[model samples]
Target: MHIGIVGAGLIGVATARELSRRGHRVILVDPEPLSGATHAAAGMLAPVAEVTYDQDDLYPLMATSARMYPDFLAGIEADAAYRTTETLVIAADAADREFLATLAEFQRRMDMECEVITTRAARALEPNLGTAIAGAVRIPGDHQVDPRRLGSALLAQVLQSGGEVRRTRVKAIEEENGPILRLAEGEDLRVDHVLVANGLNAAELVDLPIRAVHGDVIRMMMPAHRDHLITSTVRAMVQGRPVYLVPRADGSLVLGATSREDDLTGVSAEGVFQLLRDAHRILPSVWECEITELTARARPASGDDVPIIDRVADHISVAAGFSRHGILLAPIGAQLAADVVLGEGGNGPLAQSVRLGRFNHSPLEHSTRK
Candidate 1:
């Protein structure tokens, strides 16, 4: 099969690699690959810390993808620089403590490996923790990865595996006899299958209910003397706002993020202030770190905040709306997209949870090729 992937972010790259490895000819189309949400993401694989009480169905998919990370990275030829570090979920005050305690209890009931510990124990694990913390929970299975490195690796592997990557934007997609991709350069390329993995842009090709959820992230480099001040990922609730600090391999830290619905402008002062303020409350030394980069990107999200993986047409499959879990869900999402393209039924619970039919109707019916 000659598959045309419309985006080169984490999901598109992953899908391209998966399809290429399976002996399919893949052409990834993107004007700026990896410059989208994947670039700004912290790449934390913490399904436990990310789980919300209302979204229990997403947990299984996230956990499955997190568990598949080691094998996934090993299979790739390039070094993605994966890191398996436990995450410490901390609370800044009494109210936050009670909220986390309840969350920990809920995770425990779900048979997740979560331990509620005192602030002293949390401080013992991360000595740089501020004294104002109320409590913490240790989710040992959560981990982290460098999404930038992963994207580079996937792109390299796809190219090495005889796949083509076109550095061009897709103007439109029309299906006359087969799927014909109209490029921004005024060219049309026909393919056997098309995967609309273009994040929020997928909605432009197909009438899927994908919206952009914006988030602001900051990258900071720790001082040479205090390089390893915090070794593990720290997630905290500071004054009812959620923030996290993920320490990278090169003595840098990623502090983020502020989740908003419809603000697509550049980075805002309030978002940066909130991130820095909450991060400092968790680790005071963060205030002394040098700010390297401040980025704002929108994650593709559905109305229900779950992924959309379904074959809307015979040769067209849509895989978008990963929301904030794009990095974590890449492996499984790629597999599911490939399965859909190959006409293999992806009937798993995770696949069913994100199937397009759940939206009550699909726009593909109106857009199908005659």
Candidate 2:
């Protein structure tokens, strides 16, 4: 089957890769390719640290995806040689420290393995930490991947598998027994199946209540902190707000992120300042690192903050609404979507709930993606 894929972010690329692996011809359509949230993301596969109020459905999917990372990265890293290791979540302030304490207790109650260390012990793990820091929690299962490298790796895999990638924006999908997609400049292409994996643009295709939530993050080029197991993902609440500092193997520290619901994608000075201020508060030693770049990207947020991954029709399917968990859910989302497209049944929970037509109650009857 010839499959049409919209958007070339991580999800799109992963979906295309999965389909191609299953011997299906894939045509990926996107303008920027990997330069979306997948580009700006810190690439922390931390479902535990990322847990909020009470979203248990997402955790199962996240854990499944997180478990899949080992094998996924093994193949990608064998080709790309990107680093994947443990991550640390830290708390520097009093209030934030208390929050970490609560998180630690919750982890204990849940029978999860995480370590709560003192300020000195935390500093021992990350020597750059500020002396005024309170303490930290280490989640060994939480890992990191270079998003840029991962994107490049996935794109390489797709191209190597004889998949076609078009650098054009897909405007809409037309149904003709199967599905036909309309690209930029009024170009029309026909395919046996169509999948929408573009983050925010999927909403425009389907009338889902998905909106883009903007987050600004700054990347700094600092001294290489490899060889040391200070390798846990560190996150803390700086000044009554949540902030995270993710360290890379190549001595780069990703300091992020400020959540703004505005639709703007431009990197703002204020956003960079907020990241720097939080980074300084969390780890004062990073103040000397050179500011490499500041980036702002919107994460696709749905009403329930969970992805909808079901088919809209026999030939048309949607796979957006991943929000911040796109990276964590990429593998399962792509695999299940590919299985569905290939006429293989799927028992995945996400495949059942992420339907494009699930939320429509208007007079329009069914959801349309044209």
Q: Which numbered prediction scores highest in TM-score against the true structure?
A: 1
Clashing pairs in 2: 87-232, 87-233, 88-232, 88-233, 88-234, 90-235, 308-354, 309-354, 310-354
Per-model CA lDDT versus the true structure: 0.89, 0.77
Give each model a TM-score: 0.97, 0.92
lDDT string for model 2 (316-354, tens) is 777888888888788877877787677686565666665
* Model 1 regions lying over 4 Å from their true place: 75-80, 365-370
How much does candidate 2 score in TM-score?
A: 0.92
State the local distance difference test value for candidate 2. Answer: 0.77
What is candidate 1's lDDT per residue for 4-112, written digit by digit as tens? 9999999999999889888899999999999999999999998899988889779999999988888789866534468888999999999999999999999999999
User: Candidate 2 regions off by >4 Å?
Assistant: 77-84, 223-231, 348-350, 353-370
Clashing pairs in 1: none
Worst 10 residues of 1 by lDDT: 361-370
